[model samples]
Target: MTDRTVTVAEAGESAVLDVLSGEPADVGDDPVGNGDDAAVLGPAAATVVTTDMLVEGTHFRLDVTNWSDLGRRAVAQNVSDVLAMGADCTRILVALAVPGHTTMADIADLSEGIHGEAARSGALVVGGDLTRADVVVVGITAIGTLPYGHAPVRLDGARPGDRIGLTGLPGCSAAGLALLLDGRGDGPLQQAHRVPTTPIGSGAAARRAGATSLTDVSDGLLRDLAALARASGVAADLDGGALPVHPDLRQAAADLGATDIDARVLDWMLDGGEDHGLLGTFPPGVDVPPEFTIIGRVRAGEPGLVTLDGVPRIPGGWDSARGAN
Candidate 1:
């Protein structure tokens, strides 16, 4: 019998190196594992770092989502976090774990998707690692820089009498998911599920407009608003009637025999995670930007949430590892 040995170079190390050096666009002066075991970094104005992971069965279904959409979503969500903090994304580092059965072309296409989305947000993909796993998992760590003399907005600053607002419509992604799960063909709802359209600049705009607290509505609007309220030691009151429901979602729900579009929209908007819209609270009398709509108000309380219509919204918030599944 003969024994064979496998080396890192033979097991895709060279392929990884090629991606780092050749595949992505121009590599700037930044030192990225060329020689030393560590990549060096210089001081910058402000540094904002965020990390997010997408699991296979939970965050995405390989059969339903394309490599390009997956890549764009991973980078876009992380960028949403930086924007939530009123920062401009600079670069991202990705870590991928995939089953050995995955094709090289899929991996390459995914990388291209990441590169394209990062570029759209004015960020670059700096580096990453790859490894074998039982399922496909993508982790992205994004770093951003805030403008000179500006502070990152945080959830703890919301105050009583502040107006709660949201940028753009909600429940589109969730509705889209429902449509796809129902075997609906390609359409607006399905597109919403595949690609969430986040308001890229609203975070910074809110900050400049004197927002006291802010967060991206990745996990339903009500749930994230609850988080902001908890962090700020206030109570959030959302006017249920004031929410913006995508027109397509309304039509799709009707087509799918969904009895109450309002309930469905509310469920997705308040507890259906992954929308990536910006939710914020501004002090009274502050001029909110045109992109945002006033959805509710902030009040003094035991760091909890409520509905402006005097009702308790859905429980079991958008927990990816729990509720959504």
Candidate 2:
């Protein structure tokens, strides 16, 4: 069905709450959710806050994804930051600025996506605002608490000789984007880019295993890892052979009938973004959680440098202000 344009008056605060269906957070002091001017949340032993926004035509496109996916992806972006800090998100605040022509049903779908993903992460919806804009921009703020230990993981703690591990697949969403651009829509690989999933439980697992540093692969493996390396003041030696490539990329390549599929797939793994996978450094001899696949090691070398199979990996990452790589 085609979406209808919804006005700010028609999609009021009550309508927004009804669309969410009380699916957001329930742990806060303001249990009623979305009626008052502000929300009150519980005090934490250590609380972490993160905010991320997804703008149409920049972070996403309406032609490829529906409003529901948009909402979920927006929430996912915020959650990944908390998870990167080695915490589980406890609540979310969603602010939506939509075009005047947007439909009420579309708003509902967006709320459904946000609430659904938050529920999956065991996070509740707190409160936010709906304002008018020329285009769609979904801003989400995630509040998280350290679940496993005294301190949340940071990007600056990695040491030389530490093992580098990644908690989820990195290239799936990139492959999905490739498939979508190649006109294969609605397939599994294509959907990966539309509503990409992350390893939700791995943050706590990494904390339990005493992860020294952590961050998620948002911009690209090398790009994000390079940031981690710079933060930790160490070198990250990535193993090209050890990096796990999702088979879907190869499948997409086969379907596209492309030459040099292996090299192209490697490019996607190396430079793609939006995967939401956690990458971290662990102490030597520490047993990484089962979900982590060791793809590299922190070693003595140039600080903030990353190498793949001992060769320096040049940065050709996705730059939002410029364009996707």
In terms of TM-score, the best-performing candidate is 2
In order, what lDDT does every prediction score? 0.78, 0.82
Give the alpha carbon lDDT tens digit for every residue of 201-280 in model 1.
78888989999998998877777888889888888888878787777766877878878866666676677767788998
Deviation in angstroms for 232 in model 2?
Answer: 1.1
What value of lDDT does candidate 2 attain over all alpha carbons? 0.82
Candidate 1 global CA lDDT score: 0.78
Estimate TM-scores for all models.
Answer: 0.90, 0.93
List, residue by residue over 1-325, the lDDT tens digit for candidate 2: 2223555456665665556545433455544565467877665778899988888878888988998888888888788888888898888898888876677778778888998888888788877877778989998999989743479899899999999999767777888887787777878767778886867878878988999999988898989999899988888899988988776778787787779889778888888888888999999888899899999999877888999898998866687678775
Q: Which RMSD values do the candidates have, in order?
A: 4.4, 2.6
TM-score for predicted model 1 compared with the true structure = 0.90
Clashing pairs in 2: 4-103, 5-102, 6-102, 6-103, 24-124, 24-125, 25-124, 25-125
Q: Model 1 Cα displacement at 319 (Å)?
A: 1.8
